[model samples]
Target: MSQTPNRSYADIRKALLAGEETALLDVREEAPFAEAHPLFAANIPLSKLELEVYARIPRRDTRVTVYDAGEGLAERAAHKLRDLGYVDVALLEGGLEGWRAAGGELFKDVNVPSKAFGELVESERHTPSLAAEEVKALLDAKADVVVLDARRFDEYQTMSIPTGVSVPGAELVLRVAEIAPNPATRVIVNCAGRTRSIIGTQSLVNAGIPNPVAALRNGTIGWTLAGQQLDHGQARRFSEVSEVTRRQAAEAARAVADKAGVGRASLAQLGAWQAETARTTYLFDVRTPEEYEAGHLPGARSVPGGQLVQETDHVASVRGARLVLADDDGVRANMSASWLAQMGWEVHVLDDVPASTFTQAGPWQAPLPALPATEEITPQTLADWLQEGDARVLDFTASANHVKRHIPGAWWALRGQLAEALARVPAASRYVLTCGSSLLARFAVAEVKATTGRDVYLLAGGTAAWVAAGLPVEEGEQHLASPRIDRYRRPYEGTDNPREAMQGYLDWEFGLVEQLGRDSTHGFFVI
Candidate 1:
């Protein structure tokens, strides 16, 4: 391991306050990172270290401080990064506890930077909004108005205002005319919480949309607090854009994009930018998740403009990296890029990129690297082994996927935690591995063999192949060897969260502007 140095919280804080380039990463799962972290620290999770670090912290020499809550994870992360050719990796002196001792602030929830910026926008621009009672009254009277949910479709499905159509933040300007049609119809934007609703409403106003627009103040949280009813399982969505409306929205968005000083790049220019080895370039498709999953540029990530603005830190942890955004309809990318440019990103919109370039699609993700060589066992062979009790199966897949379907008796294990996880399982005559794709399982074969000193094998073609071959699979969290710490459960994600937790979440968001003021690291500038 490289003898990487340690960085004091005070020194890190000073560098942040001075606006020097730095990435303070919390090398823990999203749950713990959300539970508490320094305001500007981005959660990269040690499990995803190799998968995400290169793109997030683009500059190899950019100073990076990794921390955990005394979990002894930072050192391991630092070493792994060194192996990956990161030049300036360091530990946050004493980890989370050390920061606390140094009198640093700890924040709750993810995307604090974007949420804080939304508060700042409202403070500076005085964006108009309607309280729950007022919006409820409007809906009750059948006012000539349309309520647009400016969140993800799943979020809208979880809970929404009655009669509201799903029009995510980036789509507000592009699809508003089609949803309301009538120039005189009022539009009310909402999210589960405040950021998207505020930004979505402001997006229309900024784009010069004719209809009077307002945000549902405090979003669903406020509505729930006000003893109002919320709609569930609603599938209403924005209709396709008419040619005339598309042109108008595109023209308006381009104007805002220009005002924000966002640049335009041809495909060739973007390719050149991507070719540059010294800096990180993040190419995003700023359309809806469904649209992105349908098709997008091969190397581009799906961020859906509004979420890109709301979770900028999550998308690009390196403060100085360049951003290139794309959308089938130009309006979304332009609007999203405008906000990012204003927020001090070196932002641009991809122009004149051919529709053919967007042929590859289906859930944006990091491409898997080549796995280490391992002995392979056919699904039929593995099934026979299981039936004869000759081998034990471990599935190195995501907890959610493992819950959905897996080999009947397979144990779920995270590849990063394999060493510790081995203690939980019964000693087997031989070990077998599998995952949804089997690629990740292949990556772990060498590690498991080295750690356990046992013969190990990878199931050929994984669960998909097994299913294709008509093998029986079991569902649910039947054999979890590790806690499901990979993802953070958001207060607004499902219907089961306590109302008090949701309310407290909203309350915390309301105070982010104050928190941003206390933490001077954020160099945000709104247009």
Candidate 2:
């Protein structure tokens, strides 16, 4: 194979400063990518390249650069991109070390850009915040206060402030009025850590909400450090908005979007943007997953506005691509577009569209490369093969899932490292590949067959299908062919994280504003 072209840190930084379209991808597992990377680098691990590349970097001709920390994954990823029809793939000169040598600032953790922007917003606006002890005193005294958790509902259910209601970030501006009702009621917003709480509280302040609002400083991390107990399995959520509240919220959200210089697009204009072959345009439905699954605009991906802001690189890999947002409730799209615009994206809110216009139903379907037809096997038939010891099952599901439950004797394998994994498994007459839904495994059938020169078959519906058939399964790490590095466990995610890790995470966030100053390419502004 020919060598991929190398791009220096100066070259990539110049394009970003010029506002040109570029994709700076870090081809390492999430754990390593989270340790340290350049400011604009998006984590697209080499293992899941085929699964995510087409949908993320939509325009094949978009300038793309891939890098890794001296692991030799960059060249492999560049070669894979070429095979996938990407014409402008290149390797970052000197890899991660090279970027450091060139004086590029390295950032830690996922969603660095959004986290930095949140800190910047706080510094510029002096957004009001209350310490955990103060908030606890108010709760103890039964003051006229309402604590709204701005993290996802599931996260809230895991561990939340006492009497904290689940009101995700995007829903803050839309639902805060009804939740607080009286203008004198004090409102408190919080998340597991700092970013969401700051952004959520600032959203209400920016929209001119009547209530006295403040973020729970350092979020749940602060609460825990103060020796406060958190309520688990809480289900309190925002109720339906009144017609009067809806109108007020819509007006407030629109004004905020306008102040941020966010653009508006009619359905006709959106169609024209979608039809452009030269420019990559992403249409996102910035609503709750339930609302999106019930009905959404065709071609719109269901990315809750809060998550879309937090994980911009994950959803829209192309840095300079145009973003179009949609929501039945007028407040969500506008509020979300405002933040995207502040983040230096050319964003537009889909305006004047009726709720009935959202005709698409069910979950978002990702675009995938066409697969060659592969032979299939039924769950029962696979059971027979396993019983006869004639076939080796290669499960391509996530390592965590495989450990939780999998076919009795199946070996867990990563599709990207199939060659290495294959050598570890005992020789068998045939191989059956499977995953959660067999989608990923189908894409690997050709490769597995070519490598082993053996008959390879796909499990009709993957391991999920086998479970549905009431087939016996077992759980253990007895047959892992590849290491479990696909996902990075965030220190603030689950309930059992160590206290030291949580405090360290808070300290890291407190320093983000200074980091943003050092890396001046982030064109962030507060309205």
Candidate 3:
């Protein structure tokens, strides 16, 4: 096989500076990729490269530079990209260490671009914020204040400020008028950490809403550190907006987007862009999951506005690609596009589209490469094989899922590391492959067969099917064939993270504005 060509950090930086289409991919698991990487390097782990690459970098000839932290995953990923028909693939000249050696600033945490942008917004806009203690006192006093949790509904349900209502970031501008109709009512926004809080609060401030808005300083992290009690299992959510409120929100959001230089695109223009084979264009439905599932524009991926801003790399890996955001509610898409435009994206809000035009219904489906057909076995058949000791079960599900619940005697394996995993598992006459839904496992059947020179069969419907058949299962890490590095644990996510880690995370965020200043490649400009 031909070795992948190397691209220097200087070359990548030049492209970014010039707003050229490029994909700086960190071909490592989410866990390690979050630790340290270049500012624009998107985490596209080698383990799930096939699953994510096509959807993320749609243009086959887009410039792609893969790198790793000396794990030797980059070359393998580069070769795989070539096999998958990605025409312009190369390796980072120095990998992670080389970036450091070349004096490029390495950022910590996933979604560094968004986090840094939040810090920049706070610094430039001076977004107001009240500490946890102040907000708690206001809640205790029954003051005319509303606490809005700007995280996802599930995260808000897990833990929230007492009296806090779940109004995710994008929904805030649209729902706040209804939630706090009185102009004197104080509105407070918060997230698990800081970024969303700043962005959400700033969204209202930018929109020129009548209410006095402020972010919950440091968000729930500060609330926990302040030794305050949080409401758990809370079900509070934003109510439906009246037509009056929706119109007001639409007007305000459009003004903000205009000020931020966001473009307005008609459906016809979007179609023209989609038809252009030379450029990559991503169509996203920037609405809540339920709203997206109900209906959305054809070819649009469901990426909630809040998360689309928070994790741009995950949603739009092809840097410099044209982006079109759609929302039945004008507020979310416009607000999201405003931020995206400031972050140097060529972004547009789909204009004047009626809800009925969203003819497509159901969840967004990722584009995948064609899979090879392989022999399949029913849950009962696989169970019988296990009982007869004629087959070894190799699970290609996420490590965390395997540890939580898996088929009895199944060894957790990574599809990308199949050869290594196959060597670890005890040899059998045949191997049964399964994942949560068998999506990934289906892609690995041919590779496993070639590796072991034995019959390989896929578990129809995967482990989910097994459980549905009332089959017994066991859980533990005793059968791990690959190490667990697929996901990085965020210190601010769960309730039990050590205090030091939380503080360290906050400290890192506090320094991101300075880091952005040092890097100077981000084309961010706050409105």
Q: Would you estimate the TM-scores of all the predictions?
A: 0.91, 0.96, 0.98
Total colliding residue pairs, candidate 1: 0
Worst 10 residues of 2 by lDDT: 365-374
lDDT string, candidate 3, 136-227, tens digits: 99998999999999999999999999999999899989999989989999999999999999999999999999899999999999999999
Which segments of model 3 are wrong by more than 4 Å? Answer: none
Stretches of candidate 1 off by over 4 Å are 10-21, 58-62, 289-298, 352-365, 476-478
Residues 427-526, model 1: lDDT tens digits: 8979999888787787678878998899999999998889999999999987888888877888866667788888888888888888877776667777
Cα lDDT, all candidates: 0.86, 0.91, 0.92
In candidate 1, list every pair of residues with a backbone clash. none
Model 1: residue 58 alpha-carbon error in angstroms: 4.5
Residue 482, model 3: lDDT of 82
Which candidate leads in TM-score? 3
Model 3: pairs clashing at backbone N, Cα or C within 3 Å: none
RMSD of 3: 1.3
Runs of candidate 2 with Cα error greater than 4 angstroms are none
Model 3, C-alpha of 196: deviation from truth (Å): 0.2
Q: Distance (Å) between predicted and true CA of 454, model 3?
A: 2.4
